[model samples]
Target: MTGHVTKPGRALRRLLAPLAAHAILIAATAVMLLPLAWMVSTSLKQSGIGLSRGIEWLPWRDAWTNGKETVDVMVLGARVAPGDGGEAVEVGIKSLASRRRFTTVYVPEGAFEAEIEAWRIRPLTGEDETAEARWAPFASVRRRVAPEWGNYREALEKMRFWVCLANTLAITFLGTAGTILSCSLVAYGFARFRFPGNNVLFLVLLSSMMLPSVVTMIPVYLLFRELHWIDTLLPLFAPAWFSVNAFAVFLFRQYYMTLPFDLDDAAQIDGCSALGTYWRVLLPLSRPVMATVGIFCFTHYWLDFMGPLIYLNTSEKFTLALGLYTFKGAYTTQWHYLMAATLAVSLPCIVLFFAGQRFFVRGVVMSGLKA
Candidate 1:
């Protein structure tokens, strides 16, 4: 009955379904990307731009259009000039009333259409009158891109950026390595070894994920303090070595179970010990899951704020997340520099995810299907 629809109806459904899906996806993508784009925009803008009404999507635009800079504009207000039709007068442009719209050019003779083409903008360096060009009035707009690369430099100056960046990279590498190795080991044991209380222990481990990090944060801090590990990266890196992450263990366990037990048996028959089997047989085959776990651990370590803030007192030991807070002061906040620093910090994660996205997704899907 359903297949008995008209050809036009069927075609319409096929067309509409994909269109709707794409529309929704595009909207979701825009929702995510707009803020990042805006951050880039804000970071590139020259500082001291207070809270404005409209959004500045692009950082660089001409003075007349974006109302950002002042230029000597020649307006064509009741003028019978010699050569062409454009006003050439130097006026200090200021966007006072409307930030979203164009600058209010105070025309000396009160011209109505005070637009770009009607006005001959002065050269930025005030050398030559290059405004009288091949432009036939009201033509294509010439856009000038002024990328403020200095924002990144200034942002680095706001905090101990190099030190923090180095610390973050070190912690991320060590932490991810430890997480993958420890989790894989624990997961192999749980997946292969038929030990007593294995199921109960697994259940307990899974349940640990439900508990908030805030619940255990103080106790862990106190323990680390007693061990004199305060203000050290050890406080962050030590736990990964012990496979304290329940979700990572669970993910690894699920992935490991997906592998054929026959492989292990075959390895054992070849005089390979359990450790040998894990090292040679399983480890080689578990690249996807390893990548997944590594990505997770890397992301967590990179974005960790509370952990670093609580443990590290000295600015020298601060992570990127901790160092970023320095941009905020009692009276003012450096939004441009903050955004620039954030973009710089987020770049590594973005690159890593894009590079290993396929592996990460496949690992997740395969783990779910098997267990």
Candidate 2:
């Protein structure tokens, strides 16, 4: 009787468990995506002005520069006292058109001039028309918002953005290709071949992953310098060709090991060599893992800052990661341009990851199942 009553409770828990998990996942995703959404918002925003004011979740249709302005001018025909005015106070034509309000003007700080006098504007029909001038800023300002699409154009124009983009793409493509080819070959050897001390060698490779990259930084830099690879992209992508990434090789090896060894034996029985077996029999089945590794390698190379900073010397050869530094200076930061350039740089990676997401998930799951 108790078991029958418990069955319904178990069923209810099973039904609610997935829903609760999904709700938590949705909240986590939103938290992760908030910064990215804000970055996109800032990319579309106008410029450096008003950034310190507050947070803006959404980009405005147009950013308008609206504020009180004070300007220096010569106040002419001023009355000495109330009801004793011999001549009315006059404002110069220069002051009337002092602002470039015809177009949306962004005055970060008010105007500076060689000469200025605070002049008050009085209504013609007011009782104080004949009174002495009182200094105050007027509200005869026209405010408007114009489309800030120029932020993109300005960001591009400010730096060699196209060059950085091209360099990044070239490096990413070469690094991904090299990593796939080399790591897959290494993974195949580790998964299939039987050699003396093979397991020991593989253990050493995995242990290397525990060493911090900083330990090898100086030696790697000196080696590259000796090879005259510094200041060139060779320092960035050449390492990928050596299967130096233990984690990627480990992932590929695990995935490869999950396949039945019967396929290799069958290929050998058909007079196919070891290399032939890997190419014809195993490579075709490895697409999912290949995609996962490619995606990881692409993103790593694309967003890699420290490597590019250490190796690259010239501005023309800079990657997008290094190009961002141009937007920041000793005293000022161009938040809009920085965000815009960042968005432009990251868009390709974002698209690639989303497009290959299914393959990536399948590869990770299959790889982990075996190892």
Candidate 3:
């Protein structure tokens, strides 16, 4: 009698549960996207003057320089390995000295001494060379001062923003594609194949998922440098070929593990090879999981700043994140322009996540079910 009485109430909840869940999801989405909204708002705000005083959301100047003025040179250093073409060496008068211009020049990785030598060797007429010596390392250099807008404009014009964008997009597309193909194949093998030490090997792969990136970065960098890939995008995209992202493989494996054994048996009976069975049958049914994996890979690589920062040495190879970092001076930052560039770079990823959220959720839930 009690069970019968409770059944109607349970039915009512089943009818209402989806609506309630949707409401909660809407609230969560709002919370998640609010920061993004604010970022966009800040990016469009106008640059105002007197930055020292405060920020205003209108185009203006901030204490424009009166005339040629001298600024001190400050150097930041990091130790590098010998024979890496990076060591302090002597130049006659000017030393690379880490940085020359307070605003634009930051020699993150290079021999400061060699930089000084390179600059010193450049031809200068009598008075011009005297002026060059005045601006030389270990001396105060004066130059015509202007507004920060010049820096922003120079960066916009000189920096390979479009080239970097292309490189980044290529890396994102190719890397994600390779990761999906390789991880899916290896994952399906692990899910269905019977072989020696398979369980132990899967465990080892799972353990690798817990390893931090910092542990592998230097060794990977050294390996790439030896391969002559240090300054290229190949280093960025090549790892996906081998299924190095253990987490993605694990995700796909978990999803594949739930597939009915009967399906593979039927394929075998139909004269299908193992790879043929997977390509023809399993892939069509794995859309949700594939979308989930694609979204994850896309988001991870799209926002990657560190890898490109370390490997790309030239301005032409700058990713959006590294390019944005240039808006900031050592002592001050152009907050307005920085914020603008930040929002510009983040919008595409935001659009992608929202478009794929439905598949992401469904894949996550269904993949966890044990058959």
Error of 1 at 224 (Å): 0.7
Give the alpha carbon lDDT tens digit for every residue of 203-225 in model 1.
99988878899999999999999
Q: Could you give me the TM-score of model 1 versus the true structure? A: 0.73
Candidate 2 lDDT by residue in tens digits, 1-371: 99999999999999999999999999999999999988877777645332433575544331121244433222222222222233222222222235333321111111111112222222222223322122122223222333356668878767678999899999999999999989888999999999998999999988887889999999999999999998999999999999998878888888888999999999999998999998898888998788888888888999999999899999888998888765454214777777777787788888987899887676567556744
Please list all clashing residue pairs in model 1, or write none if there are none: 74-87, 74-88, 75-87
lDDT of 3 by residue, 1-371 (tens): 99999999999999999999999999999999876665544444333322332333233321112145433222222234342234423222112223242332222133244433312222222333433443243332222223344334434444445666787788899889989889989999899989999999999998887788999999999999999997788888899989997777887888788789898899989999999888987877777678888887887777888998889888677677666565344214455455555655677887886898886666556546622
Error of 2 at 275 (Å): 1.6
Query: Cα deviation in Å at residue 328, candidate 1?
Result: 3.2
Q: What are the TM-scores, per candidate, against the unseen true structure?
A: 0.73, 0.71, 0.61
Ranking of predictions according to TM-score: 1, 2, 3
lDDT at residue 18 of model 2 (Cα atoms): 100
Q: How should the candidates be ordered by lDDT, best one leading?
A: 1, 2, 3
Please give the lDDT score for candidate 3. 0.63
Q: TM-score winner among the candidates?
A: 1
Q: Candidate 1 or 3, higher lDDT? A: 1
